[model samples]
Target: MAALTASQAPGVGLGGHDGKGADAAGDASPGDGSYDMELPPLESPNPPGGSAPGGVGDKSGIPKSVLAAYKKAAKSLATSTPGCGLRWELLAGIGKVESGHARGGAVDKEGTTLRPILGPVLNGAGFANIKDTDGGRWDGDTTYDRAVGPMQFIPSTWARWGADGNGDGRKDPNNVHDAALAAGKYLCADGRDLSAKADLDRAILSYNNSSEYLRTVLAWFEFYRKGTHAVPDSDIPPVSVPGLGEPGGGPVKGTPERGGKDGGKDDSATKPGKGSGGSRGNGDKEDGKDGGKGGGHDKPSPEPTAPHALERATDQNITAVAGETFAARPGVRAETAKGKSVKGVKVRFEIRGSTQATFEGGAKEATVTTGADGVATAPALAAGAKTGTFTIRATAVGKNLGTVDFKATVTAPQADKVTRTETTALVADKNGTFADIAVKATRKGKPLAGTTLTATLADTAKGPFFSVDQQGKQVRTPVTVETGPDGVARLSGLRADDKPGTYTLTLTAEGGAKVEVQLTIKG
Candidate 1:
């Protein structure tokens, strides 16, 4: 469920929308099931004054050329899903916000290409080592990166949501047409109703996966729209699925099938396996020696103890988001040395090292086994977890004893959420330092775009210096500034040396969040 929050106006600068709740547009019936209608082509809403679409220099930084590209792309997608009018400028805005209009090549911190919208590019050459090899490794927890191409779909997500828009057989998310169609299709499935406020808001939430995220996107939309209107219905085409009746209609089949050409699945959908979903490696093979040895050995036993040990219990691997709670399914394997299923032996899951933390395994233990199905789960942990490599040891004890090792790593969360709140001392010299400093806040390691920040500084003996406004304006008194899309605010040219003592910098944000720092000036 989306959290309740308010939507703030754009002029408020750094502070996002203050209004909360979904738009009350058309509502779908509960238990209505999924939509199975033949899908229509996508379309765009008409703008006010019917003026030419806003371009980059509309002073909004949205280039006219890019807007034109959006229009062209929207036209083609409209052919398949009618009543789907995605704003040309919104598409451009997303491109700008995500990957700097493809100029920066949307990359994670480790420099790996990310899909602008849908991603985790399945079947791509770089999927296996993406976590270790990519330059833009978000915080260490996220396996995906910023994204490449105009669409900005993260690689992993792209693997699941990508499609062949031009029918060229290649599902290139970087292609503008393909990306735009996917964006529109994603919104529709998420229940975006251009005509209704609630649906549109909910659709936005679906896009970012959070209510706060939806508000930020909408605020940006409002800023870009300024005088523009929604894309008109006339430009959109009706959906055309062979079996499904029409767009938004109930699903033709009870459930959307998996492993299809389009790759559309409900967010709440589940996959097969003994765990919550499935594991990264082979799900059914079990092989290794018993746990009679200690936890820190370098290699496994040379030969398999059970004849089918390698075939029954498959090795499990996971990349954990440091400081977050996650569960591993099929946590234990119920097998004997012969690879036979053990009916009543209780298996235990444990972790060792500086990476020590806790899970929801009922006790200090992460989890226990009920039967022979190899399954174990872990509880959530606190933030600020120690960063490094860790080992997960799975031990099974029935009449006989056995153990296995599955390698794992713990890394920081991606940039979406920032964990390190720092206070650095600034040196003031003969040259006056830019008094105004911008504090960029990140949530989940990703920049928390559009946050409002208020900075107050009191010199021990010098009193107040000057306050800078959001527009970089220097005012005589203290002032409040909102953060931009990068979650940054600047207080330039402060008279640090003039104070000659300890100065305290405090920042308070919306949602009642606050951060403070101390600065020392040396003569």
Candidate 2:
């Protein structure tokens, strides 16, 4: 793996540039001094799928075309470097920070940003003074140059890392897909393993020698990884500080504010200073320009440690008849070693067994984010078409958190039958009471007591069944009754209006059988 070259040209500004301070020296050597440190690694890989687990559609607020480009580049890199685990979220983070995922211009079907994105001119006033290296070929400036594209690559840097992400013949910085892939390649250089936090940080720093820049990028990265849309702040050019103002408070003669003046030079440098405040700089310089105050390359804060290992708890194992829904009580809880709750952790639920189970709520897979109570509930589990036992497993995001498994049993009833009682024809009278109807449930030729039975009338308008309880209140359709000691459930007080019609009643016994009967009511 090639280490990022230190002799590279001056960086395109990484943040807002106020042009108030003297220009940082150009050609300060990439990855020099404070920007020269190696990064540590995080524990897990943030994979590059469109949505978070169990989430669907585009939720990152990024344009579908741009997001697709990042995903493609990530997949290509990951496929090529088996263990690299490069993910699209990281690329998205960089894109968001660099250029709002190419929000500065119109992106066409070819994933090209119709408008060229350029940063401030690296004149001594506030940014590094880069004597134009592209010879007015890409940026059109024979003097100083600017950054370009969605990822904001200076011509020199893009030259070393430009890639063809869209399968097109040429590498174009204006094309988002190509720019994103090039950015990924640049980050993954030096054989840096992103799975570790240190390496990820180092890679991001190399992109733009700024600690704040790294933080902003990582924050967006986390949001993207969670399948949440995170809109980058507006790209208003930083206001020049009052006393530190430039000659005209505008860009120099050759360098343009928004894009390259001519196509001769590549305007791929980053924004000059930090946003709004215009406090930070990109930190590199060239020739004799005053070295701008680069954003400090400081190590990020340490990762938070849980006091205790994560654990899974369930109220009870699930038991249901085949084809019925069994609500799983699985709940994930994280704690410190001292038994304190660890909130905000993500827990994922997976089903495993000979029989398949569908997660309730139409989720392809169930995942929940832990709340303040440190618990996430799995959706209801529906048994497979055939009866059998299955296992539900709950796992935390990181390996440090433990895992738990729960078993569920689904059984098919044997010898269950529902029989309807023979009854005379019912009449629709002014008073509305009809003839009595009854049904019996049995399992293995024996009465099935304590079974709940439900009855529904096919046509509710013509003959509405109303049952009066001890309170004499009328209960409408879907009348429910429980089987007695003899396994008999009876229905009475069925009413029909003066308009006579035929009606069908459906009877269903819990865990038993279903039967429907036809009845005629005459006016």
Instruction: lDDT for model 2, please.
Output: 0.57
lDDT values, one for every candidate: 0.40, 0.57
Q: Model 1, range 1-523, lDDT digits (tens) per residue?
A: 1111112111221111222332232221100111112111122232334332222222244333344445655565466555655665555545444333332222222112222122222122222113311222211112323233445444344445555555543444445455555555555553344547766665554444334444445655655565433221111111111111112111222233322334343232112122211111121111223433322212211222221111114336666566665444325445322234445445555665556555553333554544435333334433236667665566543222334565666665433422223344555653256344657666655676656666666543353356446996544454577666777766566654354555676766654566666556665
Model 1 root mean square deviation, Cα atoms = 26.5
Query: Residue 9 error for model 1, in Å?
Result: 25
Stretches of candidate 1 off by over 4 Å are: 1-58, 104-148, 165-169, 227-523
The top-ranked prediction according to TM-score is: 2
Steric collisions counted per model: 130, 53
Q: Least accurate stretch of 10 residues (summed lDDT) in model 1?
A: 27-36
